[model samples]
Target chain A: MTKLLEVKDVVAGYGDGPAILNGASIDVQPGKVHCIIGPNGAGKSTLLKAICGMLKVRQGSVMFKGQNLKGKRPDQVLREGICFVPQERALFPKMTVRENLRMGGFSMTDKATLEKRIDEIEERFPILRERRDQHAGTMSGGQQQTLAMARTMILRPEIVMLDEPSLGLAPKIVQEVFDIMKVMTEDGITVLLVEQNALMGLKHADWGVVLDLGRTLFEGPAKEVLTDPRIQELYLGGQKAA
Target chain B: MSDLIQILILGLALGGVYALMGAGLSLVFGVMRIVNLAHPSLIMLGAYVAYWAFRLYGIDPLIILPVAMVILAATGVILYKLVFEREARSAKYSEMTVLLTFAFAMVFEGALATAFTNTQRVTSPAYATDAIFIADIFIPLGQLYAGIVSLVLIAGLALWLKYTRFGYAIRATTQNREAAELLGVNVNFVGLVSFAIGLALAGAAGALVSFVFSFYPSKHWEWIAILMSLVVLGGMGSILGTVVAAYTLSVVAAYVGFFFGATWSTLTFFVALFVVLLVRPQGLFGEKPELA
Candidate 1:
């Protein structure tokens, strides 16, 4: 299959430090929901950083469509139709919600397209629309996450990467966020979600990656990885096989 | 009644200068968490530039005003892109800026001393000696013009911030730099331009104040102290608060000076800052939430 994004033997790290991502490989085909779940410090965030061009890749190649993605700035990667929604503090606190959406269109020169995206996003995400005039900081945690998701969608990115999206949220809000992510994938945008809660992620994610200490220990369909006894022993605190 | 009226006029005029000057330095700190000690030095440089341009080319100080502002604006951008930008990558940027600009302030002062020497310099343009009288109140023509222009500029800045797209980006950056970047706002470019505009405010004020006051290199410390008090008393980065604090401090100073002497005037600013800090350590109109 012609992959939309291919991470072929990618190795990356912070500073002159040892590579946190040691020769990891993954692929995200168009309109596929690929979820990566791993234990603590498995370099989930680091891997996401590498994909978004925040951290320099020490080895191997990252291909976006047919083009090689190396040495590209975060903003450049964004214009290349790759949007990243960070785990926390997604919205600019002091600015109004409408102001935050305008920033999403910074790379788009077409004013009509930008405004139309804003209107569409606000409609799709009612919380953002209701509070468009309100300062983003005053919003609740769940609201902020929803706004963050809405912001990336404004760009109409080829792949939207979310890092620990359910972090620090109530179970109900978590469900709400995941439901939105499901709808997003329905719009034909590939989603790479790094979720620490393996059960929920494996259930919702179409594909599963088991990254242990920054190296992929298992890669297969979500159902098989979730049911695999080995994954249950390590990730699920040695629970009995399903 | 006449004395009270004159005191209000003089106090408000002096306060206008303080508001304009302090706004620039406070803005840099509010957004970047930087304490730019070189701001006062740069303002001095702006003053000197205006002085020279007018004295040599007979260019009206008003006409040369934008030139001085532009020169300082470019300098501010370079200063950020080179030093402050790198330092700002980490949380410790604000703390490091103190020493960095402290050294920079010394370098600027030394340069000024070598060029202008220790001799006193004054911009005694014809307007500097002019005065006006209305009703029972007497006003210096230069002070009246300065006050009016200061109000206009402050209003223009407020409008730009409230209504413009650039203002939205600046506010976003100040709120959260990383989030602003994630949204696709060019944080680096915004930071550079923001720094330049902040410095330009100080430059414009310095040009206006040159007509009213005399200067020496040592005056940098004195002005820095006054600006710190103004910024601290107002709430860092609160534009309206700065204007109010400036006028309040200047009025108190003028009244105290009129009753006592010129020396007693400077003391009022300290007293005001001290009393205000007791109530709100963050200053009046402080931010609702801590950014850093």
Candidate 2:
């Protein structure tokens, strides 16, 4: 199958800083959850930033659906059907849930279509509908995370890149997040996830990309990488695969 | 009893204009993270616009308000493009903007001084000296009109922010700029338009100021301190906070002026501001500081 999105030998970093992603690359399959796992400072999140045009790409190219996205602005990238949800989940704190949903489809000019999409989102996440008038910042973590994921769906992007979706959630909430990942794929959206919970991430993903020292070390089927002795020893707290 | 009521009424009117000035400053800071030290100078310029239009074209200051707003909005575009935009890319943007705006304020003050001289001027329309007596509480028509316009404009802005698409983008960008960009909000455009709106608000307030108070080029030096106190008291970058704080402080100042003297009125502003800050350093509506 053709790759839905490809990042080839991309070098990127923050301003005046050494490249965090020296030459990281990944291939995302359509309608599959691809989790990137690595140690601290491994450029997992940086790779997502480079692809989504948040961070400047010094070299290499990001091709989505066979179009170059290297120099595109973040807004331009979203127009091309890619959305990124950073670790902070960047919700408008003072705005109501309904208002936040409206912001999600900001690029869409038609009010009817925007409201329709918001209705669809609210239907899928009933909690959002219940708290539609409540301020987003006041919502609990799990609810906010749900809203973040749901907000990305407002654009109906082909690919959604998420950085640390499970960072601070409880185990039950983390399970719910992975369940949402399942729902996303079932809805025909590809998910590119950077997760610190290596074992849990691989368990939920269809494929796994291992990043080390600002580069993609290797990638394989999720079960293969999960059970690999080397990966288990280095990242999964040294639990031998049964 | 009537004297206290009179002071309260006049204080509320002054508060309305203060809210307008504070809203402009807060919007600029909220959206672009620019303190806009040039804010009061822009207001002074707006007063001059009202002054000039009334003097030259025989236009009523109220009738010329929108024209002044447009001119000030254009001035905002030029200022942002020529000055603020370039400084935005720096690592020390916050600090740089403060200094840059301060310099811009000086330049504007000097330019106005050169063109119009340091002489005080007021826009005297037919109703400027008229007063409405309502059962022993006489209300100056000019101040009452200015207050009504200020409150109406503020309500319009509040509705715009709540109901409009661009307004949604602005609120989102104010909350999280990167996230807004990710969601396809043209943040640079939002920044430019918001900065323009901020100046337009200043112009509106200035037009009203001309009707009620005498102003000169250097008068902004005094106004700047007052405006800054209002913004700080309301919480930096909070429009609602600024409005509330403006009304509260203005009322306190009026009360001080009524009881003590006119000189104590100005001093009351800072005193009230400090008292509030002493209680809530983050500001009246500012979010509490988070641990790193």
Candidate 3:
């Protein structure tokens, strides 16, 4: 599989704070679901942010299709075909659902192309069509998540970086979100996911990386990580050897 | 009854002008969370622009309003780029802006005073003292024209914000900056344009003020306080609310002055503001208050 994005020992943090992501690295292959799972504060979200240019990379590099993404603004990163859906339900709440989707295509100035893409998204997510004129904030949590996914999809990004897509979702809704990720990969889109629910992440993702204290603890096939004795013990809640 | 009707018309005309003055201050607060203390100073500068245009070139203040708006809009852009943009990202941005804008107001006041001195100035054209009478009600032509122009400009601003793509981006940024940025909106650029528009509205208001009221450099101090009361009554960041409050306060002030004395007219603004704060801290149209 060819790598679509490569993060080489990236170091980053908030203003003047100690580094949250200390020399962390990952490689995401095209048309694959690459999940990063770790303990809280292990820098999973920060890793995603650094890749998407929301956080400044202090050292190392984020290479997308052989071009370095350092010093690029978030809008510049989006123009380069990378889209980020934040952990929060990042919708313009007061705006109608249709308006929220329109904002997603902000980089595209061509009206025809934007409308065509919106039609495609509406077909895939029928809830968006039903509540097109309703304010986004009035929707339920799961529906908002689906709308957020649909908004990012409108960009037709080469790589979609999702930070905690399943956070705060019910178990069934979590499965539904992962199913959408599966569908995205089937359509030849790369998914870079940071998930806290390790079991579901490992089950759905084709590849997985386990991070601990801002360093990669393990990297392998998702099934193998799911069955690994240490991962099962720490993350999967396997009975500890008493 | 005729006297009451006359007072109502005069009050509404005054309120219309106040709405224009307060609109920019409210918009800047709504989008950027910055309380621009220098807004009235910008209005004063605009008044000077209109004053000179009428004084030197025989041009009507209304005719020269577009020129004043363009000049002040450019000034706003330059000020945002030089001063406010850098501080916007800081943790102490809201607090920093208050002090920074206060300093800007001081500088403008000092410069205007040095150039024009404290002598009161008014722009009086051919129609300055003319009045239109209908059914025992008399309306000064200058106030009538200023009020009509102010309402039309405010309406235009409302339409631009609701219909245009750039306006949509601005509303999105105002609602949530992080969400707008994530969706590829250049939030910094939106801030720059919004500030410029806010200042432009102030300039337009200033032009109207030159004909309706006599003013000096220090007059901004009183105007700022009155404008703040109107904004507070209407709710900060709400243009529609500002308009309603402006009209309401102006009518009340006119009645109070008619019954009691001219001195009590200014006192009515503070009384209304205090009552509104006590009853509904969010103002008439605002949502629940947030940290500034």
Residue B115 displacement in candidate 1 (angstroms): 1.1
Q: Provide C-alpha RMSD values for all models, in order.
A: 2.6, 1.2, 2.5
Could you give the interface RMSD of candidate 1 in angstroms?
A: 1.6
In candidate 1, stretches whose alpha carbon ends up further than 4 angstroms from where it belongs are: A16-18, A238-242, B237-241, B272-279, B288-292
List ranges where model 2 is wrong by over 4 Å: A240-242
Q: After superposition, how far is residue B241 of candidate 2 from its true place, in Å?
A: 1.0
Of 2 and 3, the candidate ahead on lDDT is: 2
lDDT of 3 by residue, B196-281 (tens): 99999999999999999999998888987888888888987888889999999999999999999999999999998889889987
True contacts kept of each: 0.53, 0.95, 0.65
- Candidate 3 lDDT over A95-118, as tens digits, reads 898888888898889978998998
Q: Candidate 2 at B63: error in angstroms?
A: 0.6
Q: Pick by lDDT: which candidate is best?
A: 2
Question: What DockQ values do the models have?
Answer: 0.53, 0.91, 0.70
Ranking by TM-score: 2, 3, 1
**Per-residue lDDT of candidate 1, residues A97-178 (tens digit):** 8878887776787878988999999888888889999988899889988888878888788899999899999999999989
Best by DockQ: 2
Which residue runs does candidate 3 get wrong by more than 4 Å? A239-242, B289-292
Docking class of 3: medium
lDDT at A146, model 3? 89
Model 2 Cα shift for residue B231 (angstroms): 1.2
